[model samples]
Target chain A: MRDRKESTPSRMAAVWVRCGPAALVLCAALVPLAAPSISSYIFYLMFWITMASAFNIIFGLTGYLPFGYVAFYGVGAYVTAVMWSRLGVPIPLSILSGGVLGVALSLLFAPTLRIRGIYFAIVNFSCAMALRILVANLPEAWTGGSLGISLSAIYNPNASFYTMMALMVLTIWTVGRVSGSRLGIALRCIREDPEAAQVLGVDVVRSRLKAWILAALFPSLAGGVEAWYTAIIDPDSSFNLLITTKTIVYAMFGGLGTVMGPVIGAVSLYALDDLIWGKFPMLNLLILGLLIVLLVLFLPRGIVGTVTRRHASLRAVIR
Target chain B: MRGNSVILEVKDISKHFGGLTAVNRLSFEVQEGTVFGIIGPNGSGKTTSLNCINGLFRPDEGRIFFRGREIQGLPPHQVAKIGIGRTFQVPKIFKRISVMENLLAPVLSSPRTDQELKAKAREHLHSVGMLEMEDRLGEELSGGQQKLLELVRILMFDPQILLLDEPFAGVHPTLKTLFYKKIHELRKQGKTFILVSHDLTSVYALCQQIIVLDQGEKIAQGRPEEIKRNERVIEAYLGR
Candidate 1:
C-alpha cells in the first residue's frame, strides 16, 4: 500500500506536462519583444495573474476572502512612489520596500483572521477603505495629497512590463509550491475545519499568518510595478475597489484552491474583458457582471474546480 | 501522576458560554493505559468536558493536569503537541483534502522525512482497511469510513492520551466492534483514552472505570457495574 503510486500518466501526457508550462511562460516572456503594441496589455495580464494567484494563497487555500486586497497594492504603490520620487531611492529597492511594508500591514491585520467568513471580508474591505481615506489626507509634500505623485521622470513601460512578467512567474511558482507542500495541506485542513486542525497539532493561527504574509508580498510588488508602468500613483486609482473585485472574480472564475485555476482564469477573463472593451465598451461591465452571475449560479467551483470535481481523472492533469 | 500511574487528572474544571454553564466543576481521573468512559444523556456536558480536557475551550475555573503538568488554558494544538489528541462527534476530517493529506496535516512538523510519514500514514490506513482510499477526498468517504479515517489520523500523531467524543455514535455495529478492538489494542500498547458517549453498551464493555454526568455535574463515578447499579444515574439518564 505504501508503494502505490498516485497514478501513472500516459507517456504523451507526461511529456506535455513537462513542456506545457515552460513553453507558455517562454511565449509570455517574449511578448514585449514579439509585439510591443500589445506589451502593455500583456503587462496587465501578468499583473492580474500575479494578483489573482497571490489572492488564491489566502482566499483559496485558507478560506479567506479578502475583499479589500487592494490595500496592499495601494500601499505598495504609495511606498514605491514616495521613495523613488521624493527620496530618490532606486526603482528595484523601492519596489522591495513596498513589498516589505505590505507584509508589515498584513501582520497588523492579523487579528482579523480570528473572525471568519463574511465578517472577515467586511472588516478587510473597511480596512482598505480607511487606508485609502488616510492616504488621501496625508501631507501634500509626502503623499501628494489627493493630487497624487508622478514618476513620469523615470517612465519606462518596457522595463516595468518585464518586471511584472517576472513577478507573475515568481508568484505562480510560489503558489504552485505551496499548493503541493505540507503547508498547503495544513492550510486546506484549516480551511475545512480549523478546530479539528487545531486538535490534530496543526498550528492554525500561525499557519494562516504565513499564508497572509505570502499573499501580501506579491500584490504589493505588483502595485509598485504597475505604478512604475503608469508613472503615477494616486490613492483613488491605487486603492480602487475594482482592483479587489477583478482579482477576486478572476480567481473565483478559474477555481479558488487549485494551482492552474487562477492562471487559466486570469488569462481567459482578461482576454474576454479586453475583447468586450474593444467591441462593446458600454456593455463591458454589464457583460462581465452577467458572466459572474452565470459563473456563481452554474459553475460555483470555477472552471478548474468544477471540472476536476466532476471528472476525477482530470484532477492530476489540470492541477 | 497521583501514583505515577494516573495519566490524566481533571480538577474541578468548569466551562461557561455566556449565561449557560455547560460544564460545572467537573472532575475525574484516568489511570495510565486504561479505557475511561464519560457517559451522559444529551446536553449533559459530555462533549463540553472532553472539549475542556483537549483545550478546545478553556475552563472558566480549575486546573487540568496531564501527567502532572498543569495544562488548562493552552491552545488545542499546544495541547496536542504536549501529547493529547481528540476527535469530534461528527468526524471532522478535512473534507476537501485527500485521506493521505488529512493524515499528514497534523504531523507536518515531525522530524521524519515526507517518505517516512507517508509510509507510516499508509501503514495506519492499512491497519484500519483504508489504505485503498488514501487518495480519495475525505468527503468522498462514507460516514463510517470518515470516522475510521479520523481515528487513524489522530493515531498517526501517537498521542499518549486521546479524547474521543462520541466515537461510537452512528457507527455501524461491525465498525463499533472494530473500534472496541482498536481501543483494547491501544490500551495494551499503554495508550490512555477518555471515550465520551451516551452509547452506554460499548462504554460499559470497554471502560475500566466510568463517570456519569448530568446537567454539567458529575452524578456518579465507579466501575461499569457500579455505574450500572447507581440509582442516581438510572434516574438522571438510564431510566425509561
Candidate 2:
C-alpha cells in the first residue's frame, strides 16, 4: 500500500521532469515564427536568461555575489569592437576573442576571492566602475573613447538573435549539468561552509575560480552579440551596472541554486517589465521596485524556492 | 610504545593572535595507531594546537611533520589531501544538504562511482546508527546527531590521522559511549587519532598517552595515570 502511494506521484513527477527541458527548447525554436516584435522581445529574454544563469554559477552555487559582473560584459563588447574595427577580424572570431578576454580579466580579479560577503561585492562593484571610467578615458585612436564604437558595417540582427538563442541553450544546459554533478554538490558545500568543504578535500580556491571563469565567459559572449546586433556600443551603455542589478534581481526572484529558478525568474520578470514599460514608461521602474519589495517580503525564496519549501516532494521534479 | 614510529610530530610550534599567545612553543609526538589526548583548562590553547596541526593557521614559529613531510604552512585543503581529517569544536555539517550529502562531499574527491559512494555512505551511517536519518537535512538533526554525522562524514575520506576537537562536548551519555566504542574499533584497525577535550574522565579512559597544557604551554606528557597525578597539571587545573 505504501509502495503504491509513493510510486504514483513519483511516476507523475518523473514525466514532468523529463518533459520540462523539451518544452522549453520547443518554445524557444518556435519564437522566430511568432510576430516580429515578439521574436525580438524573446531575443532580449534569452539574453537575460543567459546572464542570470551565469550569475547563478558564482553567486548561487559558490555564494560569491559579484556586483562587477557587468564588467565582463563590457569587456566583451569592447574586445569585440577592437577586434572587429581595429584589427579587421571577422565578427564571429571577434566575439570568441571577447570571451577569452573576459576569462583573462576574471583571472586578474582572482585575488578578490579571498574577501568574503559584502566586501567582495563592494570590491567587485568598484572594479566595474573603474573599468567603465578607464574605457571612457582611453585614447580615441583605439577604443573610440566616450564616443564608443559603431559596427553597423557588419550589423545583422538575425545572426545576433540566433547566436543568443544558441548561447542561452548552452548556458541552461551547463547549469543543469552542474546542478546534478558532483562538482555542483561540492560547490554547494562550499557555499554552506568553506572550512568544512576544505576539510572534505575540495580545492576551494580552484573550484571557485572554475565557476567564476565560466560565469564570466557567458556574459561576455552575450555582450559581444548585443554589441553587433545594436550596431552601437558606448562606455556608459556597454558597462551599465543596471544590467548586473537586473540579472541579480531575476535570479533572486526565481531562486538562486536550482536549475529552473533563474529561467522562471528571467522569463516572468522580463514579460512583466515589457508590459509595464511599454504602457507606462514613467511608472515602470516604480512598479517594478514595489513588486520586488513585495516579493522579498512575502516570497524571499522566490517562486521555485517557495513552492519546493511547501512541497518537498516537488524538488526533484522542479529542478 | 616508546619505540613506535611517530605518525605526527609537532616541534616547538607557537601561534599568537596579536599580543595573545594562543599556543606557545608546544611540542609533542603521537605514535602510529594510538588514541592520543590533549587536555587543558578553558583557553589553554588546546584548540589552537589542533588548528596549527591541520593548517587552519600557520604557527608563528616551529614545524609540523606528518609522516616525515613538512606540512607547517600548507593550506587546509592541501593538508586534507595529504591524509589528515578534522572535526571542528562546533560541528560543521552542511546544513542546507541531507545527511547523506554531507557524507558524500568528501567521498566525491575519490574515484568511486555514485553507487559505490552511496553504499559506503550508508555503511558509515549504519555504523553510527544514523542510517535512518540519511535523508534528513543536517540542520534538522539534534546537536549530538550533527556531531555524529560530522564524524561519519570525515570517515568517508579514510584519512590516516584524525583530529577530533571536543568530540564529547554536550553529547548525551549514550552517544559518548558509542563514540568511545567507535574510537576503540578504529584504533584496533590501526588508525591514529588526536583528541582534544576537557572531559577528563573520558580522556583518562580512552587515551593511551596524554598531554596536559596550561596557558599555552605543555606542563606534562605521559600515560593518563601520570597526567592525572602530575603536580603541575594539578596546579594548572586547581589554580593553586
Candidate 3:
C-alpha cells in the first residue's frame, strides 16, 4: 500500500504500481465473503477513500482548500434519504439524484471561486454551516428536522458496502486519469499561480469551476451510500466537520496531488484510527491534532511526496 | 506583412490602487511588427500600464483597443485568448511541474493532439537550447532559466502581441543576447511587442518607438535618439 516501502527494488515497485489498483479493488470486493464481521470497517474505509480522492481534485490540483466540503456530502445524504423514503424513488436513482443535486449546489457556490486562499476557505465553511442550520430548521414533515429521516427498513449492509467500494474505485480511477490529462495540467498551473496561468492563456476561472464540480460529485455519492448503509441520515452526523478534517488529513498524509496518495492515506490512517483511537475516544482528537502538527513540521509533503522527492526514479513508478 | 497600421491603442487609461495612481491618462499606440519600449524608474507605472493592456488590472478610466476591439475591462485569460501574452517581473513558472508541462499548460485549449503539442514543445525548447531539460521540474531551473522558460512558454502559444516585463533583469549575458536575437527574429515574423524595462541600452537597441514614464505619467515619447536628447527623460532617470 505504501508503494513497496523505501527499500524495495525498483523492478518490484514498478510491478506493484501497475497491479496495485486492480488488487485493491479485488480485495475490497471480496472482503464480505472473506470476513463478514469486518464489513462495517471495510465500508468506512471505502467511504474515506472516495471522500479524500474526490477532495484532492480541487484542493490538490486547483489549490482550493474547501473547508465546507461536507456540505455536498450532507446534501447528498439528505437528498437520497428523502427521495427514497418519501418520494418512493428507486435506490440507485435516489443516490444518482444526490450526485446531481450536489453539482447543482456547486454551481450555486461558484461565485466563491472569485476569492482565494484562507478567505475562500472561511466563506466556504460559513456556507456549509448555514446549510446545516437550514436543514435543521426545515419542516420535519419534509426534512425530518433534527430528528432526521430513517430508511432502516430497507437497509442492506452488503448492497451499500459494494456500492461504496465501486465508488471508491471510480474516484481513484478518475483522479488517475485527471492527473495525467490536459485539464489536470491547467488546474495545476492555476494552483501554482493563478494570475500567471491566466496570462499564459489558461482559463483560470473555468478550470477552477470544473475541478470544483468534480470535487463535489463523488463525496455526494459517498454520503448517499453511507446514509443507506447506516439506515439513517441526521444533520449532525451528515454535515460533521470531522468528515472534512479526516478527509484532508488522509489526503495530506498520503500526498495531495498524486492519484494513489489519498487512497493509501485514507486506508492506512483509517486503520490506525480504528486500531488505536477507537479505544481511547477522548484521546482520539488530541492524537489526531498532534499528528497533523508533526506532519506539517516534518513531512509537509506527506508520505508519498517526501519519498518521491528523495528518490525521483520512483516518480514514474509510484505515480 | 509588416504594415503601419496601429495594432494596439491605449487611450487615456488610468489605474488607481486606493489613493495611489499607478497609471494616469497614459495613452500609447503600437504599430504592427514593431517593438514599443516603456522605460521608467522604480514606481513609474510601466508594469501597471502593461497590466492594464493585458487585463490584469482594469483601468479606472479609459479604453484599450486591440485590432479595433475594445478590451479594457476584459479578464486576463480572455485577453490572452485574444492573442495577447505577457511575462512577469519575477518568473512565475509552474514550479511543481516539468518544463514540458509548463509549456503545455498555456496552450491546453489548442486543438492539437498531445503528441503534436509535445513535438512542438520539443521544437520550441530545442530552439531555446532547453530541449535537454524538458524532464526537469521548473523549480530546479535557475532564475535566468526560469525567465527563459517563461518566455519560451509564451512563444509556444504564438500570441500576436507580447507584453514583456523586465525580460532581462537577471538573465546571463549570453542568454540575454539569445533573447535579444529572438526578439528581433519575432519582430521579423511581424509579431508586436510592448517592452517594459529599466535597461535603457536594450530599449535603445530594440525599440522603434520609446516612451519614458515618471510617476504614472508619460513624460516623453519618440525615437530612441530623441528620447536620449529629452532633458525630462534624463532627469527622470538620473534625478534633477
TM-score of chain B of each: 0.97, 0.97, 0.99
Error at A111, model 1, angstroms: 1.3
Candidate 3 residues A179-298, lDDT tens each? 888899998899999999988888888889999999999999988999999999889999999999999999999998888789889989999888776689888988899888987899
Query: TM-score of the candidate numbered 2?
Result: 0.94
Error of 2 at B65 (Å): 1.4
**Each candidate's interface RMSD, rounded to one decimal?**
2.5, 4.3, 3.8
> Over the stretch A20-126, how does candidate 1's per-residue lDDT look in tens digits?
77897788777878666588788899999999999999999999999999999999999999999889999999999999999999999999999999999999999
Which residue segments of model 2 deviate by more than 4 Å?
A1-10, B1-3
Lowest summed lDDT window (length 10), candidate 3 chain B: B131-140
State each model's CA lDDT, in order: 0.90, 0.88, 0.90
Measured with C-alpha atoms, the lDDT of residue A292 in candidate 1 is 80
- Location of the lowest summed lDDT over 10 successive residues in candidate 3 chain A: A1-10
Cα lDDT for residue B27, model 3?
Answer: 95
Query: Which scores better on DockQ, 1 or 2?
Result: 1
Candidate 3 per-residue lDDT, tens place, B1-240, comes to 578899999999999999999988999999999999999899999999999999889999999999999999999988998999999899999998779899998789999988788888889898889898887789889998999899889988889999999999978899999999899989989999999997889999999999999999999999999999999998998898
Where model 1 places Cα greater than 4 Å from the true spot, the runs are A1-14, B1-4, B238-240
lDDT of candidate model 1 versus the reference = 0.90
Inter-residue clash pairs, candidate 1: none
